[model samples]
Target: MANTVSAKKMTRKIAKRTAVNRSRRSRMRTFIRKVEEAIASGNPNEAVAALRAAEPEIMRAAQKGIVHKNTASRKVSRLAQRVKALVA
Candidate 1:
């Protein structure tokens, strides 16, 4: 229970932020899934295009604190590697 006025306001703010973050996180995952699907389908062009779209979304999620910076970079690296392998 938030008794203080400031605490109550903070709680409300937190709830709003939580909803926004959840939406952003879900969107980021959707982009990642798209990239994975493109990769799994084994079309180099599609995979490359999907990666191009997803990379920025993943990085944005990290920037917004939804994921760690290192985790974002690692994910991008692995996905890029897979895409490269598919191309080769």
Candidate 2:
């Protein structure tokens, strides 16, 4: 449907970028899920460690433009709070 050469190139590029972003987002979710699982199991030490590990991955996804900065910050804040509660 793209008659222009540039448009065709852009479509191809977008498809590639979409695949990459999808994978990045999926990986980020996996990290978050690990932390959540640790928290749900109620092990403060493991939860804390999982949160620490997940934090950077989430931030990195934001930095790479795969996710919004506020979204990443909110997730980290909530996870940290939950971990802290587990400690208390």
lDDT of 1: 0.96
Give the alpha carbon lDDT tens digit for every residue of 22-80 in model 1: 99999999999998999899899999999999999999999999999999999999999
Q: Where is model 1 more than 4 Å wrong at Cα?
A: none
Scored by CA lDDT, what does every candidate get?
A: 0.96, 0.95
Model 2 alpha-carbon drift over 4 Å, by segment = none
Looking at model 1, the pairs that clash are: none
Candidate 2 residue lDDT tens string, 14-33: 99999999999999999999
- The CA lDDT at 50 in model 2 is 96
Best by lDDT: 1
lDDT of 1 at 19: 100
Lowest summed lDDT across 10 adjacent residues in model 2 is found at 44-53
Residue 64 lDDT in candidate 1: 97
lDDT, residue 29, candidate 1: 91
